[model samples]
Target: MSKTHFPLPVRQLAVFLSLLFSGYLLSCTASEAQSDTPPLNPNGDSELALLMRAMFDDAQAMKQQIKEGKTPRPSLDYEKILTAEATEPDKAASDTYKVHALSYLQTIKALQQADAAQAASLYENMVNSCMGCHKALCPGPTMRIKKLY
Candidate 1:
């Protein structure tokens, strides 16, 4: 056929494959950059650990409100817990734990601000932080954290 060109569909497929491969390469590069970072331990019981624990406690209390058929208190004061954790992040088991602890505190605050449906969504994130940390440095409390969900 004297080198007849490929069809338009083949060109589109080639473009799509190229884009997909590029995305995968970028993701792999980003993941590799984070691979050397240390894991978190949310249950270490240091200051950050304590803050994470307190955050979880607050989350549980909110859940209890639902169970008891009561509204969550609007003045739960999540900032206090966050401030305490931020003030001394180095005391946490790891930097990742400190970061996640702070994030969990904010999530609790958001839950308080959100409607019941939104609050329920935040609950999953709270549990995820616990599981993420426990999977690395401290698996001891992972079971209890799972129960919270």
Candidate 2:
């Protein structure tokens, strides 16, 4: 059999690309779980919960489009929904909760700029951010958020 060799630079590029692909796959899988709709809020629907429920629906639509190899346009109301104050107050005014919420916004910005190649991954990251916040501030919805992945 003839010996085959790849040049050092070419091999390096291959390695880098492989690592990037692996990371993307891991990110996708890590968030992959069956997302179920959150149980109705016991205290009745708060404005924040309503906004999140709407956002989840929009995200699912975007995910479906991505799975179909289509580019998704960001929802026009996303920013407005995100920035609106919760009609019901959080249990506490903790910085950690605020950070997670901010991360969601930043992830949305990333999704807004995503191309076809990047949209799915960005969407996964955004979902993960939602899960992270819920884990801290409202563990009840964690499983539901996981399904978004």
Q: Estimate the Cα RMSD of every predicted model relative to the unseen true structure.
A: 15.8, 21.0
For each candidate, give its TM-score against the true structure: 0.48, 0.65
| Residue pairs in clash, model 2 | 34-147, 35-147
lDDT on C-alpha atoms for all candidate structures:
0.64, 0.77
lDDT of 1 by residue, 90-148 (tens): 53446776676577666656656776656666667767766775675567678768777
What would the TM-score be for candidate 1 when compared with the true structure?
Answer: 0.48
Q: List candidate 1 segments past 4 Å from native.
A: 1-53, 74-93
Among all windows of 10 consecutive residues in model 1, the one with the lowest summed lDDT is 84-93
Pairs in clash, predicted candidate 1: none
Model 2 score (lDDT): 0.77
**Which lDDT tens digits does candidate 2 get at residues 22-100?**
9999878766633544547556676676788888888888889899988876684655544555644654346776688
